[model samples]
Target: MSLSVTKKRSLAALAAACLASVALPATPALAQKVKNKTPAAEASASSVDYVVTIPSVEAVQSSMDEATITDILSGNLAGNAAALAELDATSITIPEITVTLDVEVDGETERGTLTLSNLVLEDVSDGVATSMRLNGSSFATPEGNADMGTISAENVNLAAILGIYGLVDAGASREMQTLYTDFLVGGGSFSSDEFSCDIGAISGGEVRGRPFETSFVEIISIAQSMEDNPEDISPELLGKFVRMYADLLTAFESSEFTFDGLDCAGTTDEGEALAISVAGITMAGMSPGIYPQLSFDGLSIVADDGTMALENFTLKQFDLSSVIATLEAAPELVEESWFEANGRGLIPAFEGFSFSGLSMDIEDQDNEGERIIADVAEFDLSLGQYLNGIPSALDTWARGLRVDLPEDSEDEQVQQLLALGITTIDAGFRIAAAWNADTNTIDVEEVSMSGVDLASVALKGTIANATEALFSLDMDEAMTAGMGMAVKALSVDVVDSGLSDIVLAVVSAEQKVDPKTLRPVFAGLAEGTVVGMMAGVADAAKLGSALSSFIAGKAKSLNISVEAKDDPGLSLEDFMMAEDDPTTLLGKVNIDASAK
Candidate 1:
């Protein structure tokens, strides 16, 4: 049969069962009650009581006939003899149903009782029969309050039930067939007091499932055979077989294994009513080799008034080992080129973990207050490489880093700085590196950050032989080697123009420091430094004379460019470490500064 047609028939059967369970008893009684309440009738007793009984399968079929069952199916399975035949012998007997009402001048009270002794369905053609028996199931309200007794279902075969409705096909697996054979639940009850309502075993109420293939009979027989003939079954073979059976059972066992309790209520405390509740919950799932099994242990929730909390909420077997293994097994899952460019088949994994005690509170708010507060006492996560490819990954990420900023903005701060004679504000940085796997040489590319016109500074340089310098751990050696390495390009651009004077004026005005006093301090420091010495010579040779003049407002704009000679670098080792100013080594660089 087509899947859709099968599903429609299955749903029709389900709907019929639900309707029979609820509406069948009330329909006739409600019609009679309405007839008695008409104006033509005289006044009757203040209360009425009635009892109903649904007869056995054969008696009900004889009374209702084929048309009645077809009507109950709602035309969804019309003219389908096989489906109707399945329901013909299905017996649902309510041995006794009692409903009573008491009417008074001030108020009225209604109570009801429903007792279902057993519901049995047998399909001789399919060679399957299932039965459900409930004990002492009842509902009542005394003094406008509700109370209920324990209800338990026994001998439920879910697979057979589904098969009767044609929901299970012939090709169903052994695992699927075993799901419903011998499923049982017991010790289920609910009660409520003036202050609180409690549900006992609401979490499936001690559910147990014994599949047909793994029946107790088979298990006992295997045990007895092993005991009777010890030499026939080797210890290793026995252990292996036991393990296999355990694994198979776990794969088929998907129901919640256990649940403790649940309670909810609204109670008055300090003349104020507040809602509160607490529940202990746990659940498990089966995933064969990928996970083998997974579960949440000691999971619970509590809430009262303005606060809610989760306690001992732990998840087991949430690690990525299985995921990595799956990916490795199916390399085609991710594009090969993408993995090669990025991680080169490397993946990250973490050890298994658990987190607990998460909470949130809605505090009482005043005129201006935050609505909620949340906290976590501790959070710990650690990352580890599944393969030895950390260095390559780091290098790839470093070389890809780039920071781009706008050259101009209309923000109030930018306008204010512009009013102080600052023009372009393009400011950002980028990092580049080169790694040669063949030679094992690590040459870090140029790292540069530039401010176009605000401070007019540009720095560009490369770090060569970085691996050796970094490993030495000697700052002086690293520095000497760095300075001696090749310089691709180096330049500094500054337009002191009135920016420095404007800044001095603002700082002096704000801090009451005299500009005359600060300027001398800056000029003295400039002349005493090696950089200052270079600047003095450049200015004397008129290399940067135009730029200096423009900063003094002699020209409208200025641009300066400096170049290092063929062997130019630095004499810092002799100057700083040896305390000797090596002028000749410094003269290797040349500067050419000018204005437009």
Candidate 2:
């Protein structure tokens, strides 16, 4: 039985999105806000609790487990390891799916585990058709449990052509492979170190108009204690963990599933830990088609760290718009090299859908070893090219038909803009800190970048003692302070090799000081000598003047000058930072220090 064309196309789209990803930074797992509710008051709230709704859960689940379809295309049995085209019992009994959660909670400690069981899958296709179902499911937690969730399915499949898992050859198997690949390309996977559940179910209308089907059921841990201590959640480790899970989830959502409904619930031993529950959901493809519309009623997460447990926790909607916008913003993120390495037989549409919006919290230990709790948000994702009209035969024949060109027309222009944007970024994050008792005062010593002010850019010069050099100026405090703190007295000496001649020069300035005072502030200054010390103040002043003259002579030997009224312009040392002279764009400018 040959699958229809629509099913095949749907499957291809799913596969493309999955396999072509490259350099996808892990998404940190954290709750996002729902639109309708007021920002949950932070007064008693110590953690975020969020609820999410999903639609077309069954359709999406089918696509998530497309690996079964891939097995069919690659000439293998379903879950039992039977040969492709061979008949296992048409119907195999699948156990009911159950999720068990175990948790331990103290005043400030939380730990838990979730177990899933009884997941059944059916073999509905021999390269011609595919289908599956989800039995009744329930959840059990240490605190309590629920039985209000159900998993269902509908008609689904990818393009007809199938052969190898990623290779598209022409034949019955090839057709099956193509369809399977398509579904996987568009659909994604739900995987975890503790558990994994994926079903690739491609859905489309049949000749007789029968619908496609697929579904999923699984368990997730509510919370856990860090290896070091309950209060010490390693931010670094937590960040990495959240990012991995988020990336995997994103890959699944982009696949063939159009979510309809999803419900999840869990609780902890201590009421202050957190309680999360979600149900009623919907989702749909970007464009209109038979693809299911996914929606969820309510999804929520509550965090109680002996502080305040977040109430009315909700993740109303997944920001698909933001996902799409990110793709549009950075296409190179999904390169052909990445698609080739990971995508193999996937389509181009899935090439560059960037994965983002992962967040987590960890215990930050200070130098003194006191713990400072902080939440870190991480964005790790990638994007790639989109396939349009198939290229010419010659292009395909020269190598494989895989297209490596940029998806957008203005790729070069966009890259240039990105480069320019970061040029001044480093000059932004410098600070000077002073500690007084329990309080610390940090002054902005330089520039600030990223708004949060985490790092500082030091304008260091690596001059090779060149007679003349130029550089760019970043409008920051380091540049300003260095100029303001110039000495009030100096010396100069210039030696000209030509004619074997030498010229000596001196310069001085007085700092204003009041005469009438209990302790007179010294008015004149010299290098390595001070005046106005009690009875011998006259002799000290004379000695200070002689020292000042000598110092002035030495300072005058070197010529340094500041350009007047130069607003954010390039400086002399700027050229030293570059491989080529910046002045090449404007020609040469001379410097004179003869004191005339």
Candidate 3:
């Protein structure tokens, strides 16, 4: 499933607040007999006194065979729960368990095997396994291979899972539910001709997937009993499902998951090699619809084309409650890209997202050996104050930036920098905006981009009558209504330090003239264009003089603004109406300019 940016954070926030994914601690395994003193050596290495390990548990054994458990798990939860609880074995240990299957590789069927050893389920009583452990595993195929260490879970309750299965099959009793109080994985890795990945230990606690009997069982049963079509599910039933699911999420007193680390490498179809590593990932304090927190630490990716890294990342207050409501209303939308439907704001409304210590090295695919590198100390975005299901206030910031230009480049941008003898840029960027619901306007308070020893440009503007229709998800509706919105006012300021001198030198060289001689000539042309463009709209000469002064090096800054002569503002409709004779309306718009 493709996720919105906010949901992607949720997925990465521990690979889907995978607190819901806290498995039975089953690690990726290879299909070979593990050689060692004991595969359970790590689990047994703990304080527990383990029983003797059997040479192997034959799958042929009818009732007691380990493979039988897999069948019972899927056949009927109602009987399986009781059958498992009745197992006479106080503790069972198996030396090896091998599984075989055929999987497609490169569009061809290839046989694969996964052999696991040191399997132990200890203290099975009252349908609860005090602990379960699988120590070693190796899986192999012609196309790939994988190996893993001990994967263990403690306090596995057969009852915790049966309840959910019971709802689906109508055979499992509430007592047949499943839950594993705690889980842990030593570590593992897998590889194929195309790619490879290494995973660090994963762990979590209070992983209870079964829902409360009163909270969700009835709704689940009703849904399960219905035909598989969303149309067949009543609005009330869909609403119930969403509510019950959310209730199930809220019922969890505690649930958390963490991925200690990850390192992966692969070759793209283009044959470009890529490597990625992440130090740690974690998600905690999760609730249905809204997740309290998810974070990533020390992530880096390198490829033939580019390299990117970040010291840390965090997402807070991830919310998908709005989408849930959509699902409840039009269940069919869920079958489509429902999250993107009209009025569904941002899929999941994330309160904020931020990253620190970021660096990027970008290489031009078309230009061999040419690249741009930069390091950014921090970047942040925050959203809040809802209007028309949209966040009225949106703020963005990026600071402590340093950029390096590739040397000896053929790119025009590079040549311009070289003309100014600029190989690097120290810069920062920021934007702030908010919606004025009372005024029906969107105020762009500021938008700024600046570089040290370079130059700075800033803008402030507003969009009037930015109503709900303007923010509608329907493109045609929004576009039609948008054309009616007024372009209220706009202001721009360009300030130069040494950048003016560099510009003059570059222009002089391009014109084959002296820098001192080009300044006035260039400034004159700029003034003339400004004066002619609007037919003396709002003191054009004064604005032209300001531009001329700055371009001629008589000033270091130029400020300009535009406003419609009519009181409220000028809309896109007005522009379109004037398209046939735009020059006729030029004098109606006022322009103001100045310099210092």
Off by over 4 Å in 1: 1-175, 178-246, 253-306, 309-359, 362-596
Give the candidate order by descending lDDT: 3, 1, 2
lDDT of 1 by residue, 1-596 (tens): 00111111122223333333321211111211211221336433333333333332332433235344433322232233234334433454434333333222224545454444333333322322344443334444452233333333333443343432333332344444332223233323444443555544422322222233333223434454454445566544454344435434333334444444445555454544554444554555433322322233333333343565555444443233433443334332234343344342233333233344555556436523433444443332222222322222111111111122122444577567765555433343433445444443434443444343333443434322333443223557657755555442354444443456777677677779887566655544533453455654544345435544554444544454444455333334433643565454445556555555
Candidate with the greatest lDDT versus the true structure: 3
How well is each residue in 189-296 modelled by candidate 3, as lDDT tens digits?
A: 989999999989988886645445442335435444342344565555554565455445443434788989889999988999999999999888565566677789
How far out, in Å, is residue 288 in model 3?
Answer: 0.8
The better candidate by lDDT, 1 or 3, is 3
| Candidates, ranked, TM-score | 3, 1, 2
Better of 2 and 3 by lDDT: 3
Q: Between the candidate structures 2 and 3, which one is better when assessed by TM-score?
A: 3
Compute each candidate's TM-score over C-alphas: 0.27, 0.24, 0.66
lDDT agreement with native, every candidate: 0.39, 0.26, 0.66
Candidate 2, residues 143-226, lDDT tens digits: the string is 343232223232222222112221222233211111221221112233332222232223322211111110000001112223
Off by over 4 Å in 2: 1-131, 138-270, 273-596
